[model samples]
Target: MAYRVQGVVVREKDAPATIETVIVPDPGPGEAVVDIITSGVCHTDLHYQQGGISDDFPFLLGHEATGRVSAVGEGVTEIAVGDRVILNWRAVCGQCRACAKGQPQYCFNTHNATQKMTLEDGTELSAALGIGAFIEKTLVAAGQCTKIDEESDAAAVGLLGCGVMAGIGAAINTGEVKRGESVAVIGCGGVGTAAIAGAQLAGATTIIAVDIDDAKLEQAKRFGATHTVNSKNEDPVAAIQALTGGFGADVVIDAVGRPETYKQAFYARDLAGRVVLVGVPTPEMQLELPLLDVFGRGGSLKSSWYGDCLPSRDFAMLIDQYKLGRLDLDGFVTERVGLGDVEASFAKMGDGTVLRSVVEL
Candidate 1:
């Protein structure tokens, strides 16, 4: 039997999302049905509303979620009914070239439910990030369910499902930040601030935060930034160099993703230092750097896809840290709201009023 649930859905390009009746079918083989407890509103959800992600109309618009498995399908042994889990998009296929090489974080093939959740009239709604978790309950592959400590706060730790995890992973995994290293994160949004916290967690001695917004810069300080630079009034590259003892940082992460910020990150690192680009860029955006300068820099320039995170490994570790009071996952939740408030939260998110507005199901 299919369960009737309410989900936030975008019906057309640039259309505001609305609550609609979603038909969540019983899991098929290798699938599980999750009863969502909480879901976080991310910029990616807004991007779906604005037609930035795809032309897949009627997209189910949430992914960062925590849920309990309510049912499991045949052959689904990895997860069982009643498991507390954090939803993840990367359900790595072990045979994929990336996974076979032991880099499951770069898995080229991930799994989703073989069955589709539909509208009352049978229109198939595209699941955002392959999770479609804005609804009361969602069906997903069993591998998508990563079991975590049930005592962890659902509203807060669910962020590990996406953006928060991306930021932390960008620092810890992609950048491979080392103890006593000097690190600079460009952008003080959710991802950038998380990078600051991740740097602290990784034992970085100096963390510099660069942003145009003074308020955000201040917030970054709470996340363990040692110094804040207002790029609006100063040359950020020069400022970073000056702060790092006339040398640049060991690692500079571009969290804003624009060409200008990328340039700043490129030049804000010490010779042979790493620059991690965790921010998502549009398809139309082209990066043109001088070939000689690229060779002259003599450093690694890498892009972080999903922060190079291996969810099965990272999620549990992060949840345990949150429980140990070592990580401030709660700091990321700026507001708690009901499902209808998601559209309003989008406006606040645009104006930088909130880090994340989460929907508590």
Candidate 2:
């Protein structure tokens, strides 16, 4: 049997996302149907609305979500009905080359539900990141559901399915920040601030937060940034270097993902330090650096995809940290909203005042 529910969909490029009747098919052999409890409004959703991600019109716009497994199809055993799960796009195929090398986080082959959800008129809806959840129910590959504690706050834990996880994993998994190390993160948006929280959780004592906004800089301190740099007034590279006693940070993460910011990150780290790019850049953007300087910078330059995270492992552990009061995941929830406010939430993304406007079902 099929299920019909209300969901958010962007019908065309730059069109406003609207609530529509979504037809969710019964789970297939390796699929599971989820009843979404909470979904976070992320910038990626806005990108989909603007046709930045793809030209697939009538796109289902939600990925960072937490829900309960309503049903499972044949051969689906990783999750069961009544299990609370965080919906993830990284449904790692265990047989992939990366998985074989014990790095499932880098799984070369990931998948989503073979069956597509669609509109009442039979137009197929493209699920954003392959795990749309701005609905009462969503269908996904069984592996995309990571079972979590039922007691966990759906709004907070659901964020782990995307942006929050990307940020935290950038610091802990990709950056590999160590105890007492110095780290600098540029861009104090949702992801960058989360990186600061991750660096703090990883035992980094000197965390520098750089951004063009003073309000965001003040917000960064609550997440464990020891110093804040308003780049609008001073040079971020020089500010970060001075904060680290003129030696530069051990790890510099460019969350802005622009050529200028990338260059700043390149010049803001210590000689043998690490530079991690967690931000997503546009396709047309390009960066040029002298080969001589690239050779002179002895540190590693890395780009983190989904924070290089292994969902099953990282989601549960992070939730546990949230439960223990060690990580303030709740702090990331700036507000609780309903599905109708999604477009308004998108308009709010520009001012940079809110962290997340979570839709609680």
Candidate 3:
């Protein structure tokens, strides 16, 4: 039987998201229906409403979510009913070349539910990132659900579904931060702070957080940054070099994804140091650097897509770390709001007023 549930949807660009009744079809082969308990309002959701992502009208907005499996479809054996899980966007196909080479994080073929969730009028709603979850229940490929400890806080762990995971994975997996290494993260939003936490978790001795806002810098300190640089007032590259014994950091991550910030990240690293770009840039934005400097840097210049994470491996490890108190997942949750408050939450995001405004269903 089909299930009708309330969800947040943006019918057109620049329109406020409204709570509408959406029809969720029963799980088909290799799919599962999840009773979403909590969902995070991310920048991606806001982008969708603003038409920054695509022209997919009436897009189902939220993606970062945690829930329990309420039903499973035929051929779905890995996840069972009542399992606590976090929904992920990437469900790798093992046959892809990236997966064949054992780097499933870059899998060219990812899977989503074969079925569609539509409106009462029968208009098919495009799920954001293939996992629209700002609703009571959502349907997804079984592989998109990563089971974790049931005792973990839903609002906190749900962050792992998107921004938080990207941030943590950028530092730990993409940057490959090592003990006693010096690292600098530009931007103190959810992703930047997560990079700081990940750097600390990896035993980085000196973690420098560069941001334009003082409040965000303070939040970065709480996430384990050893030093803070207000880029708005001073030169970030110089500040980073000054913080690291007149030599730049061993690894620098650009979390802001602007051409200017990317340039700072490039020059703010020690010779042969790594630079990781985790920020999502707009299509019109282009980055340019001196070819000589690129060659002279002599280290890896890489972009981290979803933190280069293998959900099966990274999710459980992060959960274990959270349980052991090594990772402060709760610090990421600045406030918990209801589904109706998502639009207001997006307004606050621009000013860094809240790290994450989670929706508790």
For all predicted structures, in order, the TM-scores are 0.99, 0.99, 0.99
lDDT of 1 by residue, 66-182 (tens): 999999999988887888999999999999999889999999999999898999999999999999988999999999999977677999999999999999999999999999999
Error of 2 at 296 (Å): 0.9
lDDT of 1 at 312: 86
**Which residue ranges in model 2 land beyond 4 Å of their true spot?**
none
Measured by C-alpha RMSD in angstroms, how accurate is candidate 1?
0.8
Show the colliding residue pairs in model 3. Answer: none
Poorly placed runs, candidate 1 (over 4 Å): none
Q: After superposition on all CA atoms, what RMSD does each candidate show versus the true structure? A: 0.8, 0.7, 0.8
Q: Candidate 1 — what's its lDDT?
A: 0.93
Clashing pairs in 1: none
Summarize candidate 3's per-residue lDDT along 278-356 as a digit string, tens digits. Answer: 9889879998999999998899899999999989899989989999999999989989999899889998897779999
lDDT-based ranking, best first? Answer: 3, 2, 1
Q: Model 3: which ten-residue window has the lowest total lDDT?
A: 343-352
The lowest-lDDT stretch of 10 consecutive residues in candidate 1 is 279-288
